[model samples]
Target: MATVSEFVIERIREWGVRRVFGYPGDGIGEFDGALGKAERAGEGLEYIRPTHEEIAAFMATAHAKFTGEVGVCIATSSPGGFHLINGLYDAKMDNQPVVAIVGQQGLDSLGTFNQQESHLERTFSDVAAYVQTIVSPAQAQAVVDTAFRTAITRLQPCVIILPHDVQGQKMVEPGPEMWQSRSSAVAPSIRIAPPLEQLQAAADVINAGERVTFLVGAGANGATAEVLEAAELAGAGVITSLRGKQVVPSDVPFHTQQLGLLGSRASYQQMKDCDTLVLLGTNYPYGQFLPATGQARAVQIDLRPEQLGMRYPTEVSIWADVKATLDGLLPLLTRKEDRSWQEKVIADMAKWDDELTAQAEQTYDDGVNPRRVYQELNKRLPAGAIVTADAGTTADWYGHYIRLHDGMLGDLSGRLASMLAAMPYAEAAKFAFPDRAVVCTIGDGAFQMLGMNELITIKKYLSRWSDPTFIVLVLHNDDLTQVSWEMRTEDGNPVWSTSQDVESVDYAGWARLLGFNGITVTEDDDVAAAWDAAFAHRGVTLIDAHTSKNVPPLPPHITFEFAKNTAKALLSGDPEGFGAIKDSATSLVTEGVERVKGALRRDDRDHGDDGS
Candidate 1:
C-alpha cells in the first residue's frame, strides 16, 4: 500500500502534469513531501517554486498560453490562495486553461476556529470556472478528474481544495485498473455548424460589398491559414485583437493593424470605412468603435453561440468554427478585384506605423525615454524569449511597441494588472524551460510594490540550480509618473504631481544584497551592452535602466470633453483631484491630436499636389 504522498505522485502522473508551479509551505506538507518522493523515484516531473502565489499563477498562465496545455499551480491555504486570485482573474478574462490546487487546513479543524481556515471556495468562486473541495478519500479521484475537465472545457481557471487531514488519512486500496481507466478519459468534443440561411446571407453581404474587413480574435486560433485564404478570396484586409496579434503574421499582405485602445489609427479608419464587417472569432469589447447601426452590415462567426450578437448588433451570426465557416463560405462567394480599397487601407497603415515610430524616437533632454528603452529591448531580446510585463506604464509601452514574433512568448496581466507578477512568472518559465531565455520588464513604482519580499525565493532558486539564468529589466523612472501625468491641468500646471518626488536609489545595490547579479545603466548607448551582460550571467540578474518620467503614452483616440477637463484640472493645480480621469483623458487627447494632425497633413498633400 502506498502512502498518501505516493498516491499524490501517481495522481499527478495520471493527470499528465509535467510541471507544477508553486511555493512550499507547512499547510502543503503532504504535497511537498510527495513531490520530494516522486523526484527521488525519477518521475521526470518538476515543481517550480516562485516568490509569490500570484507569480506562480502568472507563470502558469503563460505556460498555458504558450503550450496550449492546462497549466497547473499549487498553493497553501488562505494567504496563498488569496495571492492567486489576481492571476486567476487574468486567466479567466483571457480564456486561458489553468488548474490551481490549494491546500486547506486539516479537516479536523473544519468550522472550528483555526489558523488559515478562511472559506477557500467562496474566496475563489468569482475567478474560477469551477471550485470543488475534496473532503473524503472516496471523492478525491472524481474531484480531480472533474476539475481537469472543467478547466479544459471552459477554457478558464479552476480551483481544487485539498484538505490536509484527508491528504494524510489512509484509504482503502482502489484497484490499479480503476485509476488507469480514469486517467484515460477522453476530453469532451465541441461541435459547431452554421445555419444554411445565415451562411448564404453572410456570403451575399460579402459578395455585394465593395470594401470588406475581418476582425480576428483569440477564438480564431488554429485557423490562421483558412482566415487568410478567405480574406484573399474576398480581397479584404485584416485587423486583430491584442490577444490575436500573432494569429496571423504581422507581415501578411492583408494585415492592416490591431484595433483597440492600444491599437493603430489605420485599423480604426479602415473599420469605419468598410462597407461590410465580418467578425471572425472576436468578441471585441469596444462596440463604440465598431460600425454603428445601419452603417455597415455585421456578420459574425464563432464556436460559442453566446458570443454571437452578445456585444454588438449583427445582421448574420454563424455558430461554427472560424476555419470551418471560412472554408464553407470561400467557394460560394464571388472573387472581386478591389485594388483601390486595399491600397488605401495599406497606405493608411504604413502612415500610422511610420508616424508612431517616429514620435517614439523623439529624444527628451532630461533622461532616457522609457519607450526607447523598451524599443531597444524589443530589438535586442532573443527571438524565442519569454517576456513577462508588469502593469502600469511598462505594460503600455510593451503593448504599443513590442512586436510579437513567431517564437516569442509574452504575457501581461490584462484585467488584474498587478505588480510583481513578472518576477515570479520569469522564475516559473526558467524552471519549466531551463534552456529558454526568461525575461521580465517592470516599472519602478510597481516593482517596489512586491519587490524585496520575493528576492529570497529567487535567491534560493538560483543557489540550488546549477545554470540558473533569469534576466529582469527594470524601468527605473524614480516615481509613479503615470499618476503624476494624470494630475496635470489644462494650463500645464501640476496640481497633484508633487506628492512623490523622483528619488534616485541604487537598485543594483539592492539586487546584490539579495544575492543576484545587478547592473545599473543611465546612458542610452549602454542599454544593449548592459542587457548582454545580464543575459550572460549564470544566475538571477537585474538591469536597472534609469528613464524619463515625462514621456506620455499616446493611445489612438480621445474625446474633446475629456481633454478639456484634464487640461482644466492641470491648469488649476488640482491634478491629483482629477487623477481618476487623467490617464484616459491624456491618452485620448494625445492620440486625438496626433490623428487630427495626420489627417490635416494628408488633406494638404492630396489637395496641394497634381490632380489626377
Candidate 2:
C-alpha cells in the first residue's frame, strides 16, 4: 500500500499540477518527501522553492493568470502561511485561480501554546474565497477537492490547511477515488441566452441610436469575436477597461482606447458623446467618466447577474453570456452603414496612440528612457512571452506604453501596488511554462526589496528544468524615486520623506555572485545590446540598466489638483490635512478631472464651474 507521502503525490498528479511554489518548513517535510518520491518516479511534477512565501504566492498567481488553471503553492505553519496572505489577497482581487496548501501545527499540539502555532483559518478567512483545515486523514480528500473546486469555480484564492499530524498519519481506510477529470467549474446561475423581450429591447436601443459605444471588460475574455462583430454591425465605437486592453487588438478600427486613470482621452470623450452605451461584461467603477441619465442609455450584459448593475446604472441589464447576447442582438439590430462617428473616434484613437508613441520615442541623456526600452523589448520579445511587472513607476511606464501582442501575457499586483512581485512571478512563470520566455521588469527600489534572494530560487528551478532561461530587466534609477518625488513640496522643500541615497548597489555583480550571467549598461545605446546578451544566455540572466532618479513619471491631467492640495498642505505643515490629502489625493484628482471634462463637453452654461 502507498504511504501518506505517496498518496499526496498521487493526488497532485491527479490534479495535473505540474509545479508547486513555496518555501519548505518542518511541518511540510512529509509533503516535501512525497514530492521527492514523485520526482524520482518520473511523475513530472516539480517543486519551485522561492525565498519568501509571499513571492511563492505571487508566482503561483502569475501561473494561474497566464495558464487559466489552478496554480498551487505550499507553505509551512504560522508565519509561513501568513506570508502567503499578501499575494493571495491580490489573486482574490484579480479573480485569478490559485490554491494554497499551508502546513498547520501538529494536531497533538492543538489548543496548546506551541512554536509556529497560529489561527491559520481565521488569519486567511478574509483574503481567501474558501478556507478549510484538514484535521484527520479521512478528511484530506474532501478538503482538497473543496479547495480546488472553490478556487477554480470562483476564480479566486483558496487555502487548505493541513496539520503535520494529519499529513503523517496512516489512513485506516482507502482514500476516495482519485478524480482525474480536469474541468473548470461552472459559473453559478449563468444563463447562456438572455430573455427574448430584454434581448429585443437592447437591440432596439442600439438600432435607434445614432451614435453607439461598446465598453468591454476582462469578463468578456472568451467573447472577443462577438464583441468585434457587434461593434461593426452597430457602427459603434469600442473602449476597454485596463483589464480588457489585450482582449481585443488596439489597432482595430473601431477600438477607441481604454478608460480610467491610465486611459486615453479618446475613449473617455467617445463615451460621453455616444447616444447609447453597451457595457459587455464590464464593471467599471469610475462613474464620473460614464454619462448621466437622459444623456445616453446604458445597456449591460453579463453572465453574473450580481455584477450587472453594481457600478454604473444600466437602462437594460441582460443576464446572459456576452457572446450569446451579442449573437442574438446582432441579427435583430439594423446595420448602420454611416462611418462618420466611427471615423471620428478612430481618428482620435490614432492621434492618442501617436502622441504616446512620440512621447515614448523621446530620448534623455541622463536617464534611461523606460519607454524606449519597453518599445524595443515589445518589438523583439517572442510571442507568448510572459512578462511580470513590479509596482511603482515601472508599472506606470508599462501601463502607458507597453502593447501586448496576441499570445503575450502580463501579470502585476494591482490595488495595493506592492513592490518586488516581478522576479518571483517570473520564476513561477518559468516553472509553469518552461517552453515560453519569461521576463521580469522591476524598478531599482522594487528589485532591491526582493532581488538578492530570488536568485537561489531561479538557480534551483533552472537545475530542475531540462533547459531553463529567465530574463530579468532591472530599471536601476538608484533611488526610491516615486515616494521621494511625492514627498517633495511645491516650494522645493522636503516634507515627510526618507533619504533617497540607494547605496549604489551593483545589481549585476550580485546576480553574478548568485551564479547567473549579469550585464550592466550605463548608456542608453547599450540597452539593446544588453538585452540581446541576456536573451542569448541559456540560464538566468540579469540586465541592470542604470537610469536617472530625476526622470519623474508624467503627471496625469487629473492628478494636478490633488497634487496642488497635497503640496499646499505639506507646505503649511498641516499634518492632519496632509494625511487626508495623502489618502484620497489620486482618486479625488481623477474624479475631479473627469467631472470637469464631462461638464465642459456638455456646453451647459447653468452647470457648476468646470474647475470644481
Candidate 3:
C-alpha cells in the first residue's frame, strides 16, 4: 500500500512539477522520506532547499513568474507557514501561479494547542485562490490536484494543509501504474480566445475616437506584434504599467513610457490628452493617473471579467485572452490617416529622454550619480539578460533609465513593492535558464536585509548552472533612500536618523569570501568595466558600486504639494535635508534648461531647412 504522502507527491509530479523550492521540517518527515526515496531511485522531482522558508517561497514565486510554470513550495507547520506569507503575497499580487504545501500538527491535537498548530486555511485565505486541509488519505489526491489546477488556472497561490497523522496513512488506490497513467494523461488547462464580436466592438471604439492611447499590462505578454500593429493602425501612443514594461519596447516610436508614480511625464501627457483610453490586460490600480470619466471614453480587455473597469470606469469591457482579442481586432481596425497625436507624444518622449540623459551624465559630489550608473549598466547590458530590482530607488532607476530590449525578461515586486525579492528572483531566473544572463540591481539596505543570506543559496546552486552569468549589482549608499524620500516628500519631515543611517559593509569582499568574483567600484569611470567583467565571468559575480546617498528617487511628475512638503523638511532644522533638496533641484533644473535649449535648437534647424 502506498502512503498518503506518496500519493500527494505523485499528484504534484503528475502536474509536471519537476522541481520544488522549500526547506525540510518536523511535520514533513513522511513527505521528506518519500522525496529521499525518489531521489535515491533517480526517478522523481528535485527539491531545492533554501535556508529560510521565506526564500523558498520567493524562489518559487520567481520560478513561476520567469518560467510560466506552476511553482511549488513546502513548509512545516505554523512558523514555517507564516514565513511564506510575504513571498506568497508577492505571487498573488503579481498574478503568478504558485502552490504552497504546508505541513500541520496531528489532526487529533487540533483543539489541544499542539506544537506549532495554527489554522493555515484561514491564514492563507486572502492570498490564495484555493485553500483546503487534507483530513484523510482519500482527500489527498483530490486536494493536491485541485491546488495545482487552481493555481495555474487562476494565476495565484494555492495552499494545501496536510496533518502529520494523515501523511502517514495508507492510500486506498496508489501505485506505480496509477502514478504513471496520471502523469501521462494530465494536460494543461485550455484557454479559449475571446469572441469575434467583442473584439470588433473594441476595434469600433478605437475607430470612433480621434486620439486613442493603449495602456497595457502584464496580460498582453505574447501579443507584442499585435499590440504594435494595432497601435500603428490607430496611431495610438503606448504607455505601460510597471509590470507591462517589457511588453512595449522602450525604443519604439509609439511607446511613451510607464504610467503612475514610477512612470514618465510623456506617459502622463499622452493619457491626459487622449480622447479614448484602451486598457489591455492590465488592472492598473492608480485611477488618478488615468484620464477622468467624461474626459475620455475607456475600453478594457482582460481574461477575467471581474477585473474589467474595477480600477477605472469603462464603456466596453471584453473578457478574453489578450492575444486572441488582438488577433481578432487587428483585421477590423480602421487605419487612422492622421498621425499628429502620435507624433506629438513621441516628441514629448524625446524631450524627456534628453532631460534624463542630461541628468544621468552629471556627476554629483560623491563623484558617482546612481542615474549614471544605471545609464552605463543599460548601455552595457547584454542582450536577453533577465533583470530584477528590489523595491525602492533601485527599481526607480531601472524604470527610468534601463531600456528593456526584446527577449529580455524583467520583474519587480509590482503591486507588493516588497524589498529583497530581486536577489532571489535573479537566482531563480539563472537556475531556470542556466545559459542566460541574470542580473539583480538592489539597494544596499535591502541587500543587507534578506538578500545577504540568500547569496549563500546562490553560491550553493552556482555549480549546477552551466556557464551562468549571475550578477548582483549592489547600490551601496548605506541608507533606505526610497523611504527617506517618501518621508520627506509625503510627511514634510526630515529623514529620521534610523532611516538615514546604515552601517556600510564591504559587499564585494563578502562575496569574494564565498568564492564569487567580487569587485568593489567607487569611481564613476570604473562602472562600465565592472559590468563588462561581471557579465563576462562564468561564475557568480558581485559588483558592489558605492553611490551617492543624497540622490533622491524623484518622480516623473513633481507636484507642487510634494515640492512644498520637501521644502518644509529641508527648512526644518536639518542640514543634510537641505543639501539633498538643493542637489536634486539643481540636477532637475539644469536638465530642464538643457532640454529647452535642445528644443529651441531643433526648431531653429527646422525653420532654417524650410527657408533653404
Best by TM-score: 3
lDDT of 2 by residue, 66-110 (tens): 666678888999988998988898788777789998988888786
Worst 10 residues of 1 by lDDT: 575-584
TM-score, ranked from best to worst:
3, 1, 2
Candidate 3 backbone overlaps, count: 0
- Winner on lDDT (1 vs 3): 3
TM-scores vs. true structure, each candidate: 0.85, 0.82, 0.95
The segments of candidate 1 whose C-alpha lies over 4 angstroms from its true place after superposition are 3-5, 172-184, 189-202, 302-305, 318-334, 431-433, 451-470, 485-504, 512-517, 525-541, 574-612
Which 10-residue window of candidate 3 scores lowest in summed lDDT?
176-185
Model 1 TM-score relative to the real fold: 0.85
After TM-score superposition, what is the CA distance of residue 574 in candidate 2 from its true location, in Å? 16
lDDT of 3 at 235: 93
Clash list (residue pairs), candidate 1: 487-575, 488-570, 489-567, 489-569, 489-570, 489-571, 490-567, 490-571, 495-573, 558-588
Which whole-number lDDT from 0 to 100 does residue 102 have in model 3? 93
Per-residue alpha-carbon lDDT of candidate 1 for residues 1-612, written as tens digits (9 for 90 to 100)? 655545655766676778878877777778777788778889836787766788788778877776677788889888898888887887887778899989899887778879988888899999998999877665666667777788877778999888887777665444465443233334664435566677789999888877888898877877888888888778888898766766776667568657765677778887788888999887788786787678788889887677898766788888787877776787778878767777777778777766566555655544566766777777766756777777667767776666766666666665455666666666666665667777788877767766655667677666544457677788886777655654542234454445655466677778999878999888777776887787778777888888766566655555575457556655565534443344334434545566677787688778895434
Candidate 3 residue-wise lDDT, 228-263, digit = tens: 999999999999888788888877977976887767
Error of 1 at 215 (Å): 2.5
Better of 2 and 3 by lDDT: 3
